[model samples]
Target: MTIGKGLLFSLLISLVVQGCHSVVFKQSFDKQKWNDKEDWDYPQRNNVVDDLVKNHRLKGLNYKQLINLLGIPQGQSEDSAGIYYQIVMDFGNDIDPVYTKNLLIGFNKDSIVNSITINEWKKP
Candidate 1:
């Protein structure tokens, strides 16, 4: 191939690869912002969930302590024996959206936190 043609092809490939990549910016968890109102409406939880799980030692905290730090969880959606804090709920025209995300905190029998996880639910 000609020099010019090779350079153009390489540039096109580079641009295509870069454009295909998805960029995600993770934020630090802020108590004031998270518990400002309610979790179901707060969409920033997805960005800060990593920071909360990584930076903070949530495990071993009792129910009261967990509540004090994270506030009330989704009592109705308490499935699989874990407290769920909604991170993102895509509400479209319909009553229920196909996509959902949450931060799930699982506790042991003693009411002490044992696991903290990010749970995503996608339409089947």
Candidate 2:
């Protein structure tokens, strides 16, 4: 190839490598955020039980309302009466990150939360 063409090809290759590196870096960061045990935000000692007991007012609360108060849930299950949301607040074990399951229970009927419970926040 001509000198000019070779230079252009080289530049293109460099750009491709740089792009790939950036994408890989971004993916690694996202994975770390998702899986890092340290990212779990456990409730403070004084407030832990209190926070769990302050259930969503069944008459006045809904799913979105609960989410607004508590943040996104880790998982959810549903049936005719309502949707049950499992809100994981934090990791129970630093060494075994998967051993803990923080549950923020939300019961929603037709998108409105009829009730909520902090059913379980324990290591399993």
Candidate 3:
């Protein structure tokens, strides 16, 4: 291959690979940012979700501590499995919600956190 043509091919291949996956920056968990609403901001929970769920970080925290860290949850998970913090809600163009994502925190009988998961629900 000619030098110029080889360079072009490599650039094309790099661009294609980069385009295949979306880049999501994982932010450090910030309690204040998680609840800041005055500036019309959201998605803070979604950003820090990776940090919270990684390494079973929330496993030993009690319900009260969880509340202290995350504030009051948006609501309990369906089937009463766990409490959840609303991470993101996508409405798109239509009025009804098209998808919803939440941080579901499950607890044991002693009210200590047992599981933490990112629950994503999408409309059919």
Candidate 4:
């Protein structure tokens, strides 16, 4: 094979390999700013949660294990069946945002995660 053709083939292979990998953007959480509506600017929080769940196996994780992995949740509530931890994400414009995403992790009586629910809302 000619040097030029070989180089082109190598470049094409590299591009294809790179395209196969999923790109995940890392997001940093601030406890103090978590509740601040003006400061809540994480558009990629859903992606972060998705990646964490995929990598950490959150389904069977216990309450303590979840806390250890994800730190304290933004808010939490208890019910007859289990406790719910709320992870919220806000994205879009300041005047009229696109949508808000909420990830609810439910822990059963044994304190082991049993359900993962994602809810999204769009502006009216």
Candidate 5:
């Protein structure tokens, strides 16, 4: 065989091997991440919020009760009268698009929740 032909053949083999290696590595890495308990595990903290929404009911729940249940608001906002607690949750897949649910629990002078608004809620 000619040296040039051998070199070209060797280059093609190397490319093919490298491509196969890349695919294998990607699959294994993704598999490891998927199998990992920490990655797949739902946040225990979120269950408390879930329980509130599922069991306790959102609209009737008071401000102090929510604070006690969910630990604390990630952040807070205030208007002319009183403050509001932000209940933010993430729900989406890896590619194409990501989504979230943001609930605003507003309070009046007595600290009872005056309104519960599902702001930017995407889930059905």
Candidate 6:
């Protein structure tokens, strides 16, 4: 083969190999478990948030109970009448798109959970 032909063939082979490697890596990644709070280094943080959301019981919990169950919030705020706790999760494939979920819990004056809100979105 001519030198130019050989060089072109080699470049094509390299690109194909690299593309295949990326596909394999992405396929092996477990998106469901990525950055899962349950797997975080902090032992206190678990999947309690998932459980609470799944069971629809956040309103039944008090401030202390909620803290004990899910540890501290990523963000917190207080007002004259109530307090808010926010938990945020960002997880998805590392490729083109990603997803995020946020949980906002509101407590009444008595420190009992009064409302729970969840927001989710996708990013590219």
The prediction achieving the highest TM-score against the true structure is: 3
Candidate 4 per-residue lDDT over residues 13-118, each given as its tens digit: 9998898675554545433333333354433454466655555577888988877766566566444443433445434557655665666788777889998777
List residue ranges in candidate 1 displaced over 4 A: 1-24, 38-40, 76-80
RMSD of each: 4.3, 15.0, 3.8, 7.5, 13.3, 9.9
- Candidate 3 lDDT over 91-116, as tens digits, reads 88988889888888898889999888
Q: Please provide, for model 1 over 1-124, each residue's C-alpha lDDT reduced to its tens digit, 9 standing for 90 to 100.
A: 6999999999999998897664445888888767765634875676778899999999999989988888888653466677888777876666887788888888888888998878798877
Assess candidate 3 and give its lDDT. 0.79
- At residue 4, candidate 4 shows an lDDT of 94
Pairs with backbone N, CA or C atoms under 3 Å apart (clashes), candidate 2: 62-113
Query: Any runs in candidate 4 off by more than 4 Å, and if so which?
Result: 1-38, 77-98
TM-score of 3: 0.74
lDDT (tens digit, per residue) of candidate 2 on 28-121: 1121233334334532322333434453244456667756655555565444454443324444446654433334454544666555544554
lDDT of 5 by residue, 1-124 (tens): 6999999999999999889863422121121232233443323323233444445554555767756644455456545443443333354565422444444677776777777654554544
Q: Kindly give the stretch of ten consecutive residues in candidate 2 with the minimal lDDT sum.
A: 24-33
lDDT of 5: 0.49
Rank all candidate structures by their TM-score, best first, as comma-separated numbers.
Answer: 3, 1, 4, 6, 2, 5
lDDT of 6 by residue, 56-79 (tens): 466868888877655566666444
What is the lDDT of every predicted structure here? 0.80, 0.47, 0.79, 0.62, 0.49, 0.55
lDDT-based ranking? 1, 3, 4, 6, 5, 2
**After superposition, candidate 6 runs with Cα above 4 Å error:** 1-50, 77-99, 121-124
TM-score, one value per model: 0.72, 0.39, 0.74, 0.52, 0.38, 0.43
Superposition error at 117 for model 2 (Å): 2.7
Candidate 1 weakest lDDT stretch, 10 residues? 35-44
Model 5 CA deviation exceeding 4 Å by range: 1-51, 57-62, 78-99, 121-124
Worst 10 residues of 6 by lDDT: 24-33
